[model samples]
Target: MIDGAAKDVAQILGHIPALRRYARLLAGDAAAADDLVQDTLERACAKWSMWRPGTDLRAWLMTLMHNIFLNRVRDWRHDDGHAALEDAPEPAHEPMAHAPEMLDLHRALDRLTPALRSALLLVTVEEYTYAEAAEILQVPIGTIMSRLHRARETVRVLMEGPTDAQRTHPLHLVKR
Candidate 1:
């Protein structure tokens, strides 16, 4: 029979692809994202005993990755030498197989703050509920909701500019 530890490792391994995607989005640099994923896996193995069996392993792993990403962001903010990924120039435009709308969405997403982006990704891309995302993000439910609202509005504004309802048009005097 496979040992419990081995089973845990297998489960964690199964989530690597997702972790990588989330990391890429959070880091915005391929090399940095890979490093983040590696760090997350290492932390998971070292902290395996803390994981409760019968719980959502994926959520737990996501939480670990999110925390690592946040720590890295904090360090980057404090460090003077290294530049944050958001400031890095956009990657050379390569032909992509995705739809144009998807590409536009990605560009808009890049503009959002890390907190908003993570909350949006968890709810929309990862299909996690507000409660699950809050647990993963270590924030209260209200915070997640607030982030989601802001993220959605930011993305909308970025992608489509202001809608007619939100646009303010200057009044023009007409000839009497």
Candidate 2:
């Protein structure tokens, strides 16, 4: 039988691609995303004892990555005379595709705020349930729902480019 540590490594390795995708969404740059994933994996290995085998391993790993990202954001913000965006390398341009829908979705995703983007990607791209996303993000379920709703609306508006109906018939909430 494989030891617990080996099993844990295998499980973590299986989820690295997903973690990298989530990190890319959160970081907005490919290199930064890779760094985030590396940090997350390192932390996971270092703190392997804390992880319980039977529970949701993916969720636990995501939580670690999210926390690490938040800390990085905090530190980046606090640094004097440090401009993170300025330091970031420019992304290489790729050839245009025939499919506009995919391009539009990517552009809309780029426009979203980090929090909204993370929430949307976790639920939509990663196919995580609302509860799982909430747990990974360390937020309440209601907050996750609210973020998802707003994120969806925002992405829709972005992809659709402010239709006339949006101006004439704004969305309204009706209390039940």
Candidate 3:
């Protein structure tokens, strides 16, 4: 039993970096991301017995983090305007010397809705298959497809600006 428990802890530890990356992208702030990761670890440890031995541990961890993130967002929405200090807008800092396109892409990603962003990140960033992403997000495969389509289109529009056709006509009227 001791050996089994130690092995489980080792496996969970190995996924920490991935969890931190996912949390960082989802939360969009380092401090908040760290908090999310900590909460996820706590939850995972508490529920360790529930995890199936042969299942995908990384995906399971991601699903737990996703649920926690969504719950926090829901709670934040219900808050009475008493925002945390971390939620306060920070003073603008000089841009890093990174490539402009990368900066643009990051900004575009930030503009995405959490649902859309999660779908995009799970597939693109995490390299999960559509089915796997759907499972992680706890949605139907078709819903995952729809979210990916919308997320891609939105990011493209945000990064490249409106196309000439889009500028000339409403989005609905502009045929792809």
State residue 35's C-alpha deviation in candidate 2, in Å. 0.5
Model 1 segments beyond 4 Å from truth?
A: 83-93, 97-100, 169-176
The window of 10 residues in a row where model 3 has the poorest summed lDDT is 90-99
The RMSD of every model to the true structure, in order and in angstroms, is 5.8, 3.3, 3.1
For model 3, residues 68-153, the per-residue Cα lDDT tens digits are: 99999898889988678799897345365368887788789989988999999999999999999999999999999999999999
TM-score of every prediction relative to native: 0.84, 0.82, 0.90
In model 2, the runs with Cα more than 4 Å from the true position are 84-89, 95-100, 165-176
lDDT of 3 at 50: 88
Top candidate by lDDT: 3
Instruction: Assess the local accuracy of residue 32 in candidate 1 as a C-alpha lDDT between 0 and 100.
Output: 88
Who is ahead in TM-score, 1 or 3? 3
How well does candidate 3 score on lDDT at residue 91?
35
- Candidate 2 steric clashes: 0
Give lDDT tens digits, candidate 1, residues 12-109.
Answer: 88999999988888887688899999999999989988998899999999999999988887987899988677996767564662588777887898
For candidate 1, the lDDT comes to: 0.88
lDDT head-to-head 1 vs 3, winner:
3
The lowest-lDDT stretch of 10 consecutive residues in candidate 1 is 164-173
